[model samples]
Target: MFNKILVGIDRSLISKKVFEVALSFATATGANLMLVQVLSDREEDYPQLPAYSYYPMWDDQTVRIYQQQWEEYKKQGIEILNNLAQQATEAGIATEFTQMSGSPERSICQIAYTWNADLIIVGNRGLTGIKEMVLGSVSNYVTHHAPCSVLIVRDTELLPPQSTSE
Candidate 1:
């Protein structure tokens, strides 16, 4: 039985499935569900290039752009988390949401360790070959390295909800 359940959610359509699975498990066990969103700092991604730029006489344009983009990303992430939390709450489950900037896998594992989560729920885009090798799958990483158990919900095609015919 899980006492603490941590679910990784992005703003992608796949996250909705992850949320459903997490909510069902949380409801069944009455566990505290923690929703996490990870955002990477753009500056970290583009390191080799000059950290700043400017027009003719200015030299802070690039830094300013990076900061603006980072803030916008965080704002978008927060909105996604809020929407997920709202949905989970409406389903009669208690949920907490948090965001951090870094490697998604690292942040997720650390939070799982910190929360001592009994289980971790994640979504799989089914990335393989080159894509999987270059951009490691978070679910795969967690499954291999998490301190606790992990549940990976594969992205599957779902049938449309049955319409009640009058």
Candidate 2:
């Protein structure tokens, strides 16, 4: 039985499924749950704000606007984690949540190791081919590099079509 379970969550819809599975497992096994949310400045992630560039070519107003939006994104991320943590805590489970900024793939594994987790749970984005290569799969990376056992949860809607043989 796992004593410490670390769950990697994001703002994506599939994260709900991941957290649900993790919470169920933790409750069943009486394991403490740690929720980790990694935020990235990837343009696609914060499409509401103008993309920040490596080189500076923005007016003061644009920079200020981008900074404000970035702060709001971080606040939202923490709020999500807080609410999820409260849910598990209310269920009488020892739960802790964290918010970090960096590469999701690396951050997830790092937290798993630092927390000495017995199992790491994460969601699969179902990315494939060019999309996977370009975006890089966080679940794939965690599956390979996690310090402990890794559980990858895939959303039902993203499952591959099944073939039937008569």
Candidate 3:
């Protein structure tokens, strides 16, 4: 039985599924859950311009707009963590969460280590070969670097209907 479980979350289509899996485990094991979301700058949909130096090359108006959007992005991340943590708490599970900005791979592992988690539950986008090399996989990194056990949840929708779910 894991005493503490760390979960890495993002704004992926599989996020809800990943949360469901982690929540079930926490409920069953009575484990304290640490949910984390890393606000990656390399968003596939929304592009976050560099936030340093006030984007000196750009005009003040553009810099302000980007800064505001970035702030909103961070806020959304915190909201996601808060919502998940609230769900876990409602289930009587001791829960905590953090929203960080940086490399998702490293951030998840760093939190897992510092929180002394017994298990890490993360989602796999199943990127492979060239795509994996270019995009880098967070689950892959976390599985190899986590301080304790790692549970990777693949997107079940990507699997055959007859296959095991979650």
Q: Show model 3 residue runs off by greater than 4 Å.
A: 50-56, 159-166
The TM-score obtained by model 1 is 0.81
The sequence of per-residue lDDT tens digits that candidate 3 reaches over residues 1-166 is 8999988889997788888888999889889989888888555745556665343577787778888988887888888889888888999999988887789989988988889999999998867789889988898888888889999999866765686679
Instruction: Output candidate 3 Cα RMSD.
Output: 4.1
RMSD of each: 6.8, 1.9, 4.1
Candidate 3 least-lDDT 10 residues: 47-56
Candidate number that wins on lDDT, 1 or 3: 3
Error of 3 at 162 (Å): 9.3
Instruction: Please list the C-alpha lDDT of all candidates, in the order they appear.
Output: 0.82, 0.87, 0.85
Best lDDT among the predictions, by candidate number: 2
Cα error, candidate 3, residue 74 (Å): 0.8
What's the candidate order when arranged by decreasing TM-score?
Answer: 2, 3, 1
